[model samples]
Target: MGAASVKPTSLPISELLSSRYPARVPRYQRAYAWNDTQVGDLIDDIKLLLPLPAGTRGHFYGGMVVIKITDSSEPSSNVYEIVDGQQRLATFCLLFAQIAARADELKDQADSQGDGEEAKKLAVLARGVRKSNLYYQRYDVDEGNESEQPRVRLSRVDDDFFQSLLDGTAGPPSRESHELLENAANLLRDELVTPATDATDLADARGKLQRLCDAVLLDSFVIHIVSDSRSSGYRLFSVLNDRGARLTVADLLRSHTLELLDDHASSREKAANLWDDILTEGADLVDDFLMTYYTSLTGKRAKREDLFDDVKDLIFSATKGRVEILAALQKMSGEVSTFKAIHAGMWPYVPSEHMQSVTEWQRSRLQRLVSTIQHKLSHPLLLAARAHSREDEFAKLVHMLELFALRYKNICGAHTGPAQAVYYAECKRLRGLTNGVAANFAALRKALNTLIDKRAPDPIFRNALKDKLRYDGGSPMKANLKELLTVLEDYRPWIKQGSSGQPRPSMINLIDLGQVSIEHIHPQKPEVIVPSLTSHTNRLGNLSYWAPSDNSAAGNKPFALKQPAYAASVVSFNQDLAELAAWDLSALEAREEQLIHDACLIFRP
Candidate 1:
């Protein structure tokens, strides 16, 4: 662990690629993931630079690339582990290979047409490009190995496919191959074969390709940073690449965790697979899951900027050995699905035997609570409770969480700063309980009452619902209001019973709410309005759900005209509109009071 020597210099893309030092992406690195967007951007950048003055020097193509130098006994060559910019290096190799392939194809065409001079010139250019940059020249190594391979080798997972692309023998990418690498190759091939803007004959195409090749090899430059060890390389990589088009917190964390487990390959693979499984849902969600998990375990908000540091601390502090660290990560990974299920509002179908005693009704309630509240503060609490608590205890826990979140944050408009810490602390407490489900359920209720100021009669929530419920137009709160109304509608005694003697809530087709739009009971711009009507137009009393088509049709219409649309609605809230004799301030107040009363009961803690 000696201090790493660092050197920074600008190198032409050609010198960087053609240098005797061969680049290798370590096995722990993620597979090549540059898709069409990235590939196209690089092409566009190079194409833009191609038309610049021939003498233009030091044109920056991209950010820095950091390599960890490795000792090679052979004097003729060197080997370096790619610490950063593997994507760019791999892509450059593919682009250059495609250019060489296109040049050779043009050479053969010219020779076939009896154009010997043109064919010879093309052949020389192609040979020079390939020989100088694309591959290693024959050399003897001290370890009895001879070198003659591609100048850039990808991570083991992608090396074979990358080599195939370099050799011009790749078929259409197989399902098993990395899609991004295939896409990058396809993008390069398409650009080389057919110019996007200007159609070119064989000669013009060759000229354009040669210009691109020259521009990339000679004109485009990168800031090359060479480090001596993996740790130094990673530090440099973070400093350089943490800015534009950056790696995510999860990416850096994944690399760090895998590096720690390097000596235990099987353990490393297990951790890697678990990480992949977490990402399989979506790459962006891993950070979210981690943040939630971290908050739950530590009872502190995990900032994205500090996520890697915090995770490293947690892993190392929990256990010093790699085996213990891997075991801890495996345990954390196992809980990922539960968080994911909760995030997706799919707790009912999570397929865990622990959830078997939890009824569909309870799951439905949990889903509604999560979807409506739409906050992350309660996720850790709920997830930890689900993992450690029994079904009945989990049901009670979800109820307490739903009440607190909806009442305190949603309706009361309280900031989540205090609540997040409390919820996280509760998560830890729940995890520690021996009879966690039942014991923690009581603990959560008591904590909510103490920390959030749970009043005996709960007048604070009811008053807040009445006074602060006015949703701003086009705000997310307006949507939350509609969802609240739907939940209240379902809770009404009017819901019909099924043959099984249970309330058939599914009869309402709540999925339609996803498409339904909120409408003003009192027209937004009424043709006839009594005094004080203007003030009440956007209040909760004035709003009801309507189908989009119906809402549009009822636009600015008088109450009498809009009554027919309300009468045809299935919502219990809308049905009350049919009985209204007039759309006046009194009517608005009456409806508002009734709705508020229902809400107080529906969201009662």
Candidate 2:
């Protein structure tokens, strides 16, 4: 299992897919997940590198395949378990199959045209594609019948579908094929067969198609690392994928966590089930959930590169016994569900029936706040508060967090590093309170307020907000601008009632709204007549939400001309702007004061 035992070599994609080394995907590995985007990216890379001269060796497609050699004695027909790079290998095969199909069509066309020499050359390419090492391999069985079989065998789930696709026998994608696999196959087919916009004749098209097929099969290469044992295979998998797209942290963690439960079959099964449940959303989300979970657990940000090591350390440090480790993993798995619910805006949908005290309204408010702030640092705090606090306490905690995040991040324009550290420390404090004592909502709020007051005191926040309004132009970050606009537009007095007999907020759900741009009420261009309003164009007073279409339509128009469009608008913010008679500096100043006043109450800490 040492590094020295791992054999690394480079081989042309043609040889790698050839009968000399047939690859198999083990049952434990995930099914093929490469979609149109990934397949397209690979094709684009190959096309970009196709112009390189022969023997130009170091052009990388950004991946390595690690295989465990099963039979060293039979070098020509060696069987190896594909430990990594199954996605790339499978995609390559699919792409080549499409190329081969195109070549066959071209050969037929050459025959019909009665061009003997061209047809002969086309036939050679067609045969090379059909008989390449990628297509078939020979296996030595007990019956001594050496028959050629599919070169690569996938897990049971996708083997038949993939083989049928490679052989061109699968008429349209069937239900048996995974959607991603179907997408890859169809995308490659369209890319290869569709004529380019330049409109080449059949002969020229066939020649170009043949050249591309040769480039991919003969010029492209993959760094192949073969390990003699499974242990070495896993090691090489980890090492090589650390730099490429082959394996992710979640994949590595799954392997490590399963190994930890080697002695307990039931625990191992349960753990695997938990892993699958978390990944049912998507494998990419596991890293996000884990990073947030780790931050909440330890009040420290975990870098992506060090995330696996950090989790390993955390697991080892939390418990040495298998039972304790299993319990911790189970708890973390539950936390992942909670995290997912929060991210999906399903706060009221608690998995535990007993933990449904948080009402849907409160959950919606928290969702709005998270969307407004657009930061993940507050996630750990929110997850912990939801788990431990009463509905009222959780509501208060959400308000405090919203105010703190908006003030520090949006108004003050503070550095995120310090704010993250502050939030992480508060998360640690809240966790300490919950674990050390019975759930004390009052104590948790008190502790949180104390920290918030120290870090972002009311006076400081108010001064910062006023200063930002007076001096700051529009927000640099679109999220911050949107958050500010949402707050201002949605603000309403408690006494107001809508047609439904509820609070008539201007904007109920900003999260689901279509694209909105910050429109200038008083045009910034010099042609638009205004009294001392040019310097204040980017201020909050001058900004209002406009649909991108409306924004473009109203571009640089004088305020008098724009007012008609604003009067026709539906947004309360724009309607209010239409009521204004003048577009002077005094009007801008008045609007600024009113907005600052509303902001003070909305963002009050």
- True-structure RMSD for candidate 1: 5.8
Candidate 1: tens digits of C-alpha lDDT, residues 182-252: 77877887874346223236567667777777788888888787776666677677666562237766677
Report how far residue 314 has shifted in candidate 2, in Å: 1.6
lDDT of all predictions: 0.69, 0.66
Worst 10 residues of 2 by lDDT: 494-503
The residue pairs found clashing in candidate 2 are 17-133, 17-134, 18-133, 19-133
Candidate 1 yields a Cα-based lDDT of 0.69
TM-score of each: 0.76, 0.69
- How many clashes does the backbone of model 1 have? 0
Candidate 2 Cα outliers beyond 4 Å, as residue runs: 2-15, 18-21, 30-78, 107-149, 154-225, 239-247, 258-284, 316-361, 386-396, 415-422, 429-463, 470-472, 475-491, 494-595
lDDT of 2 by residue, 1-605 (tens): 77677777777776677643568875445556676778888867766644564445334554455555556434363577887778888888887777777777777777888877777776777677777745553546655766666677775556777888888876554432366777888887776434421124556766666556656667787778777766667666666666324556677776666556656778767766666555655557777887888888788877887888888788744245667766777787778888886776556344464345445444556765666565566788777765566665766666566665776666666566766766677677767774435444455445545545666666666566445643244444545666666655655543233223422333344433237766777766746566577777777677777754454476688887888888777566777778988788888778766666666555643
lDDT of 2 at 396: 60
- The deviation in Å at residue 467 for candidate 2 is 4.4
